[model samples]
Target chain A: MAIPAGITGAAWLLRTVIDARDLTTEVAMVYLAGVLLVASRRSWGPAVAAVLASVATYNFFFVPPFYTFHVADPKFLITFGVMLAVGLTVSTLAVRLQRQADSARERERRTAALFAMTREFAVETSADEVARTLAAHARTLLDCEAQVLMQGPNGDLHPCPSGAPAVDDNELPAAQWAFHYHKPAGHGTPTLPGSSHLWLPLLGARGPLGVLGVQLSARGASLAPSQRELLETYVAQAGLALERVVLAEESARATVAAETERTRSALLSAISHDVRTPLASISGAAATLLEDRASVDESTRRELLQTIWDESESLARLVADLLDLTRLETGTLVARKEPCPMEEIIASAMERMERRLAGRQVRTDLPDEVVVAPVDPVLMEQVLGELLENAVRYSPDTSPIDVVLRREGDLVALQVEDRGPGIAPGEEEAIFDRFYRGAGSAGARGTGLGLTVCRAIVHAHAGRISASNRAAGGAVFRVEIPADAGPGTDRLSPAGAAL
Target chain B: MSPHRPASEHPPGVLVVEDDRRLRATLKAALAAHGFAVTDAASGEEALALAKERAHDVVVLDLALPGIDGIEVARRLRAWSTVPILVLSARGQEQSKVQLLDAGADDYLTKPFGTNELVARLRALLRRAGRGDADPTAAMLIIGPLHIDRAERRVHLDGEEVRLTPTEYDLLAALAKNAGRTVTHRRLLAEVWKDRSEEHAGRLRVYMTYLRRKLERAGRPRLLTTQAGVGYRLNAE
Candidate 1:
């Protein structure tokens, strides 16, 4: 008001002091300056007041009614009207430009904030990381603190471990209810209006995934409509990120389940073939011995009898392997631990395998002192027997098999080496699979259960087993069982002991 | 092998029940040659009928029967008579062993058991049952010209010496001891080594080749014979 008023008074004084009665049209410039000053300094309303004052003052002092309240010339009236129109036009345009600049600035700020949030969301690691990102952004944009609560496995809202505070116990039910119902609750909402925190559900295509609890500043207990809208948008993005995390987890689980099924089916088919092959020979031998007793020569009868015996022995071993797999699957593999000397276990296995390895050279490399460890003797014997059998089966009759036992970094390492063709490239790990045949051995008699059984027994003993191709033209199978450790690795079954 | 089950006073009646038809027939014939009056049955029901209708010294039942398991048969037979139940199961599963033993089976034989072991186990079961008139005890085994004397642990073929390696002698003795029955490869290996091995059953083939060459004179029927995948056997019956 003062700016418009002062500019109008200055123009009136200048017109009076200049003593130029003929400078009537030029005097319009002084009046125009007053209108422009008010438009720039103030709003359009005050500038309009200046416009009306300039028009009236020009009529009273500079118009044809210079001395009287009458227009001496009608042309002077046109001048007064044009001057008034120009003032009004200038003031309106100034205000319109001011509003346009302010709006552009607001839009630019919003776009930049949204872009920052989107970039953060792109590479978010976990549901919790998404929560922190959204929460921090919310605090900045809304000018208030916010807590993000995601639904856990139980469908209850749990705050992320780091960023958000736990939803107060008393208010937890309300937050969960809001997330479940996909509705807002607490302060400013129709429900729970007196509560200090506002809970807004993060709804998605998969229903509500979580909730956002915003803590308003002391300026007011509620957020203005625009701020509330901004909060809703932030929560919506957070919900999307959380949904992505869960979907990724679900897909990974499904893939694992599918892979396990494939492995199980492969193992079953391989076992079935092995079982039938032995059964055919055994049953056929018994039938022939019964039917051809009178006709067949003594030597033929003897041959038939031997067929049944050998097949039955291998069949027994196969059945034992099946039982072992079952026990591992059922988590009932109970090991009876005792201090067993490796030398003793090796000797027992070797002695048992005497008839099988009579002509072959079995070289042994062992440490001098007793390498005693807590293990089930029978199970370890089975492991050694399987490894020795595997070596003999895959390798030629001429090549010697090597068995070495030593201490390796907190473990007792046993390496079984054979000079046969080294494991097929990339098959070092695959050979441990239950159904993985020895592809390297052409027509070798391998059911593939030997190595699988070895791995299982070693793993149950809290050990690691690996197969590697030695540069010396053979494959080395190594088993490292943790030596003399705490009781944590032992699997104790109450029922097994009682039985 | 001489008839261990003597028919001195009255031959003891024995029931043979097995799912495999050929195995059952072979067992019946073998038991008959050993001087026991063997009655054969293909199933548990038929065996139960023979048990009720006829007097038998012992029942040899296979655990894996077509209709009912040997455990159920053992339990049902125990309810009526004091007959000894000898269970022959292919699985040799320890759990089944425990159950069958609890269900009144007097003795259990794992599959591919030697004929000698089967006869010995059954005889021991029968003796305990007090049906001791026909005892099963062999002093010597004679297959054609092949002679095996258990007392001396010696083998004689074709009136000449049939020398054997220490392991070969033990192996031949094990096969001749259970002349007409099956001996598992692992059991035969253990017999040779004096201990069991889960490793190579293939090693037995080398010794078998040697025994076959030594025992088979130019033309006379081969004494020691190969049973393909099974252990060697001397066909005395």
Candidate 2:
């Protein structure tokens, strides 16, 4: 490795050429090195050292007329001035570009981290699952041993296990304090500056979802301020995702509870009214026969049997009503709507209620013109029957019950009016509620689902039914169904209409 | 056989089936005093078994029982039998009457029924059963002094035609058919009301009272007799 004399002179000449280069060029190169050092490692002191050494080397080797500290040419003054200017300019440009690159890289990293966190949160079905996923992600992304501590109602941070050292109560308190304040604490933060763990609040719009406690290793102390900010962003995104999951779960539970309540109410009403009708009749008949056998002579005995028969028929009607209500409420009742004569439906209902309305005087006000409506025949008959029955039960025995049919533009209105005590004030709304009965109408035997059933039927037909006090001292129930074109324009005989 | 006018005459027998021992016993003794041959069974199984052994003109059955509920009993008895089955059940559970009838029970009576009402139902059922297979032209059919003309749907007492409503006439016709047998409440209702509800059995009592008042006008009421808790029976002899 010994050098020869001829090779030594060549080395010296090369050094001379290097020294003779423009001072500004030499300074520019040195400043460029400083900028690169700062961009890669972010060491302020090293960058400053590079700047000083580059300055000193420029003045000593490239500023003078030889290897001396003096300028032999005055023109060299402009060289020194330009060298300083160029050095500062290059340094500023280099620093600005490095900072821009670092910021862009940080944003990309945070965005990817946020996406990953959101994906994890979306797949989690339970609070515990969210907690575990959050903790695991925080540990990996934060590049430190991390723990997710959810604050319990009792103000305790329940640490989720990441298989790392558990965050102590004091550390958790610090984390909770940060969460409560929705700010970061410990380590580089203004609060608890010397602490080892970085306590970041998982802040969301509602509040902090939890706290993320990152325990940095010895090597992790070199994490820059920007790195902490990036970590905080990840924590905030995770918090928002967790909040969304919690809200969704609460709403789902509420929906299920509401559905269950509705089903239970329906079952109770059906069993109480529909199932018991037939049983009541059978019991009544047996009791009468057993009690009065001797007094009831042969002819009289026959009469008692007639009563039993009538009651049995009533039972069948109740069962049918129950089935219809169930089908309607469950959305299974399909209306096979067709253009049918309204008078036919009215006649059918009256015929069915003949025995029930035997004692009461029935007055009809039907126009000679045939009225028609688009409706399901079976359901329409049932609706009319219920309305008539309701009137019979409430109205005075001797009072006249009126059934009026009239056409209102685009709608056919069928009104059944009873002279019974009008529905109490404020009860009009409640009357339609399933199983709701009037206050003074006690001892009235009905399933109380009649009006509700009627409403459902009408709603299915896209029509309306309402009850109100009549202008003339009685309650009037009006059902307005959509008009339709149909045959049967020839009015039937009055006797045929009377049932 | 002709329709017999309502007169002061007693029915023959009635059948009662109830699970409660006290209720059944009380009904039987009461019915026997009313001139009915009161038959009783404590359970649906016992009732079915007894009914199979002998033909009862009328049967009063309770819906609730220890084994094979009353509805099932009605179904089984209806298979080969047209005997009137009257059902008894507690109040507030009136819906079972339809199921019982659909299962072949004729009629129903709610609990706490009056003794007078029970007798009237039995008589109606017995009268209807006795008229079985008889042509409408049968003449001069008599229950004591009461004479019925089937063709005219008329009844006569002491050689005078008695005025009667359509319901009253139908009632008399049912009793004349089952002259000797005890008829339960259910049979009478099934025949008269047809598709009418059993809950309106109270109306039956009102009608029977009207019939009795007309029949007892001569102060020698021999036709209608109350059979306490069981039912009414038309006397054959």
Candidate 3:
């Protein structure tokens, strides 16, 4: 009303200023212009109102006998009819144009939202992560609470273990139904309409992978048609991402299975050969002592008894080594890492091997300042012990063995060096493989699993262990692990008392 | 509970708790041959019942038992008795070894152990326990070439006075008090540092290193030895 009134009032002033006699058509043209301007900016209702106001103001002010609705000439009625017809046509076209612009904006918003969802899904590595990302997007876009429940191995619907809340108990049946049937159901659908949340199936290329449950806010009891479409697109992308994650996991499991199959056979052979050798010696010695009790002299009896003891000890060590290898390979041996001094680990390993090391010349070269590393004390000590045992088994007893601990860069390196026949050329890495005994150590008593176990422990600590022949005439095994602190007392305070 | 034989004439009693019957019988035979009046139990419940019936000189408890696991038994037993407990555990049970030791177990021996090792540990515990529960602070501790006069707060190595910082001295004294026995890391920490958290383990090792350097002479055997994942021992040989 105001738009038409203001435009016509300005036109009347213009006509009076020109003071022209035959400008009636010009005045009618002015009224038509007012109607078109109003219709372009507003909907049909406001545009129609602007047309009526323009006609009344044009006739009463500008036509002959202008002060009244009564017309002086019958020809003025045709002018009124033409003006009304043009106003209706312009308002209808303007209404259609306004709707097109509004729909274009809505489509752009939906496209941008879908693109954002797909971009986030591309980086998700697991189904749970995908589900979580999808749920967060749904909550923001749909203004509702959203959760995704995936199909389990047993064909049951289980909520993805993400930040999304678990599906309500009453709503789980609807979610399961949608997943089972691969169809949308629940609150806004025909099936299970009493449910508080709407359950939509995430349909992949093969079939449905999961169900997405959305609980609309109070004001959003019914989603607009376009929002419903966007929700469907979100579920579809989530399904594809979930399938990719599942396939990747399956392939990884297959690779691990094949690796386990290989090691299983190696383990069997190690048990049959290494374990039986000790058992044969232990049983033979015991039988000899038992059968010749009276005939055996004091010295002979002592020798046979000593053989039994030695073989039994070796058998115990083999069994222990095998058990450790199994635990490490199966991922059951969890390393409990802590900040530990390297000297302590070395000292502990030496103490544990004291009986075997008693007659050997073992020299330790420790840094003047202490080196501390984040390591599992027990497991790291085991690594050192295995290296020492290797040195004792391969090297001559009279030769000196050196244990050195040094700090290099961010790593702490512990090297066990021996003054004996070095590793055979090109056989250093092979020795760490399961049951790969050294060629020169023909008569050495070992399970052949010691170096393998050491490598596994080092890997568990995110470190590396390797064996190399020294230039001087010996083999050296070096282990490098991440250090928590360098050789200094700055980071650590005196523990017990003020020193 | 009364003993059939007089305390002075009877052999030192040992209660062996093992779930496996074969191992239990073997433990009984091994302890008997070593001159211990051995009583065996197949579970923690039976061990607790047997302990109440007779005053054993020592207890050998397996950590993996069917009923009332060894740690719980140790806790319940320590509530009333100060009897020495020697835990028998497997190789991978190092984490629990700290808990058992902290729960009042005197010491532990990993499984598949030699009878000689078991007898030695039991004897050391009996020796330490028999010296009475009171502090052995007034006496002189002579372990290998190192001599510690606890009353005088002084140490002499090969008749030469060895200088040690207060923390190093306190750590050495703690180990010396349990000479010839493996005192756990938790026990040593509590005794010297007044803290029992395993976090102080590295600090204890540093002090041990300092003490070892001070007391050790060239060409001589190291008197202080590490028990690997467990703790430390001062060899008195």
Q: What's each prediction's TM-score?
A: 0.47, 0.36, 0.80
RMSDs, each prediction?
A: 17.3, 18.9, 5.5
Tens digit per residue, CA lDDT, model 1, A134-157:
888887877676788888898667
CAPRI grade, predicted model 2: incorrect
The order by descending TM-score is: 3, 1, 2
Number of the top lDDT candidate: 3
- For model 3, the DockQ equals 0.43
Whole-model alpha-carbon lDDT for candidate 3: 0.83
Sort the predicted structures by lDDT, highest score first.
Answer: 3, 1, 2
Instruction: Give me the candidate number with maximum TM-score.
Output: 3
Per-residue CA lDDT of model 2 for B118-234, tens digit only, reads 777666656666555334456646776667777787888677778877777676777666554444445666666663444333334334444544554433534654322223344
Candidate 2 lDDT by residue in tens digits, A1-499: 1111222344345557676454444443543444344433433444444444544444555455646667677765665565445545555666677778878997787778778877878787766667677667766766777777776768666876556677766675578678888888876678876667778887667887788777764344566666666676667667777787778877998998898798678768766665566577667766878897897787756766775665555555455556677788787777656555566567557755777788787777877666656676657777888999899988889898999999888889999999999888899778877667897579776767778788888877888899898877778888988774333211222312332
What tens digits encode model 3's per-residue C-alpha lDDT throughout A46-76? 7887787788877788778878888898888
Write down the lDDT that model 1 would get.
Answer: 0.72
Alpha carbon deviation, residue B25, candidate 2 (Å)? 6.8
TM-score (chain A only) for the predictions, listed in order: 0.58, 0.45, 0.83
